[model samples]
Target: MDVLEAIVLVNDMVVDSSSRRNDAWPELDDLSAISSSFYRDTDIAEGYGDSALEMELYRLSIEKTRNLVSSGDLQRQLGFLPSMREIEVLPVIYRDRADFVEKILDSIRSSPKNAGISTELHRQLNGFTQSLNVLPDALQNFALFAFRGFYYQELAHLTSASYMPHSWRSGIIRSQLNRSVSRFADVAIGAGEKVRSKLQAAINDEFGAQVISANFPLIASFVIGQASRRSDLLRTAVEIRDSAKATAFRAWVYEMERRIRNEQDLDKVKQAQDELTTLVRELEVDLGLQRKPTQEMTLTLALPLPLTPSIERTLHVSSPAWVRRVLRRRTHLVFLRELAQESISLPPFVRSYQMLKL
Candidate 1:
């Protein structure tokens, strides 16, 4: 078959496998009940055990291939539109690999006791184990694409609400962006730890203490490096998302300024002013300029009594702390007001340059 035909065949296989897996769940549940019963026969128990193992291997295959098919990067590479269920499943898949490998190994080790299980089934299980033995290499390839997929997913989520007011959308997207970065870092580090622990354990089992001692540090350093690479990818993703947000905000600010300059309606001008005020407050917060509590100030005024010879009186006045905050905000309000009233005209180039500086 040609490449296109092969792609179609693989897609068909994935769909069929996924459907079969879904259909098998109820039967698996029934098997679980049967295996747990007091009257269960030996043959039935053995059959149930083998079925569960086969199901697990089958499920993993389906999930891995489905993840590959659903990957955003793969879709982009192949110039295909993403499916409705296009979601990043690699983190989950990778996270479960350690336990899955352990289970497979345990079954292999105990195979001699299960004399009733067919030779064909044993061969299939061994084949599955051999396939999984190459997982460290597979993970390296899959992880790069998976990280990109996650970044694109988050970027799309953050920028999707174009209908919302720019000020509100900006604040929400920034908050979400921060949270997403934190969450992605945690997941990447956690997955790395799991894989590292599993691989280290497998090496220890195979080679014993002397070999492990010699190679332990090297293995640890490699895992840590992988985790750090994931963090770096996350950083790049954040920068791209942040730059996109800044560009959108600049466009919005320009539009609002244009409206303020040319719109005849007082209400529209006022609306623009209000939106700009919100945007300015958000910017101040983002820039670390609006966090401290306001401070009160005391002023002394000296007055001379009208008829007395050089008689002087002093009056002390104090302003409320909140007044300072209002004054600070008033600076932006005045600029917005000037824009609304057409008292100041900013050239487009200068306006864009100022925004870029922001």
Candidate 2:
């Protein structure tokens, strides 16, 4: 089979991306599959005869082709997002005009010019490098932006406490966008439709890159492989898990257990019960409950916060430093996430929240 055939089937397991079709990249289902008399036999031979890099491309090609077999309507639905995230971090956008042209050609051939993004295709793609400006911000949310919007946020968090230019994002953005773009291309082509030119350019810039395709899965696997390393990343995951409120919950549980263990004096029993009641009241205070009783009406005061950390909650944390960091950033990401959910969709991970608009 052509190169696309090899990898398309690999995703029969990874149900995240094209999870719509068992995680395979739809590009594989297109003309490149072995079913196509054109490149099928030659591709398998090239597997042996080609350079190791070419062979890998041949292999990825199989995934690309296999992916094409799924329903083509994906593009019409997800036309706005770009295919790659690196396109954003790139100091210079564009310089990859031919690739975008290839994308629009594929899109138009598959679907109507009016159905997807519906703007004039020719007007959007008029600039090559100039089009690169579209890589940053909310615009990056589209399939054209690929996963750049998400990855951009992640790397910004990873690179520095504050977002800044860095070399590392190249690797991060590459992997994310590859998955995003391939999926977008799959559905886009399947639907036989066209979106805006900026989006099409993004698809090409991301998919066209040779460097990104090579490092993505390897790095992603490595990053994902070490449970410990990931545990250390962003320094906020653990903190979020063991948030102060969560710690309080555990403390309350321990006090509850301690009371259960001791069944002696009725006064002691009553005190324990009162303490537990006070703790719950304190929680309401910490959460900023606003229904203030102006008068001393039975004193429904909030309980005080515990001075000591919750031992059980602390133990659950794999890494406290990362957890703490995440906790620090969480408020910001939460607001951003709210905006994303309300205004736009935020990607699945904290990494997707790295860069911010306001």
Candidate 3:
């Protein structure tokens, strides 16, 4: 058969198999079966394809399987967060720049982090990154500065006694961070140059000179205030004043906050946060940071952070509390395994987190 016919046959096999199985997770069984054939066919198509039709059939079959799972089966499996499932399914429905943004935010929200200063910083970073493009010129420069401030602040904590002991694992994380920083340094610097150009342009506009001078202190104050919210970071900034790095760190913070007041379009703010979080964890080889208790830190005292205004409104209007409760009860590990089975590459930190428990 042709590619389309082969895809149809594979889908029918999976769907019919699901109907026949009399188990709690017949769908998973169907998935397992289809996944096997998809892989087998994919190998043949890629490696031994004597004709274009054979290659096309194998590729289409694989594509069809992913589409089916992402839209239908993955929902039932990864129901821990409806938004996450929606994120995975969204590509099938909408394929545009705006939707790309939605997809990213959804991915960021789905990323898990421990409750503490780290998590809060992660959220803020995400918000900043996602909103970067839409922000006013002054704000965009501020965001980059603020981002560097937070990055260093968090990096300091990870290097602290409270986060991880000085061991081989810690060394690995440091090495990874070093590499990541090295690789991204040029990119970050290039972006910074652009921001500086924009800042200069804004300054040359009207009364911009006085405004620029005034902006540094305002941003510095905000960065300091944010640092104060996390005892470890605040302690690092204040107590470690002698270090030149600390001085430069705070300078970057002030420089960034000099112009921006607040974030715009909170919903789009996931990229900065997600990227930082992902990179930070990538520093870890395997559970590189030793876990510490933050029970005394009053995590509950922190203000509630709704996903986005629109999501918040929709949740209030439609989704019932019981449904949320049920979603929380879903087996996270099972869903994670299913995602892997479907040939989805789970993020390293996520895989590490789950594996450490086992």
Best-performing candidate as measured by TM-score: 1
| Candidate 3 local distance difference test against the native | 0.29
Query: Model 2: runs farther than 4 Å from truth?
Result: 1-95, 111-124, 127-295, 298-358
lDDT of 2 by residue, 140-162 (tens): 22223332233233333433322
lDDT by residue (246-324, candidate 1, tens digit) is 2343344444445644655657656644544443443344334454334444444445766645534544443345543
Model 3: per-residue Cα lDDT at residue 120: 46
N/CA/C clash count, model 1:
0
Query: In candidate 3, which residue ranges exceed 4 Å CA deviation?
Result: 1-183, 189-193, 196-200, 208-211, 214-222, 228-358
Error of 1 at 5 (Å): 45
lDDT of residue 174 for candidate 2: 36
Task: Residues 108-172, candidate 3: write the lDDT tens digits.
Answer: 23224322433443444344345445534333332232222222224334333112211112222
Q: Which candidate is the best by lDDT?
A: 1
lDDT of 1: 0.33
RMSD, candidate 2, Å: 22.7
- Overall lDDT per candidate, in order of appearance: 0.33, 0.30, 0.29
| RMSD in order of candidates | 24.0, 22.7, 29.4
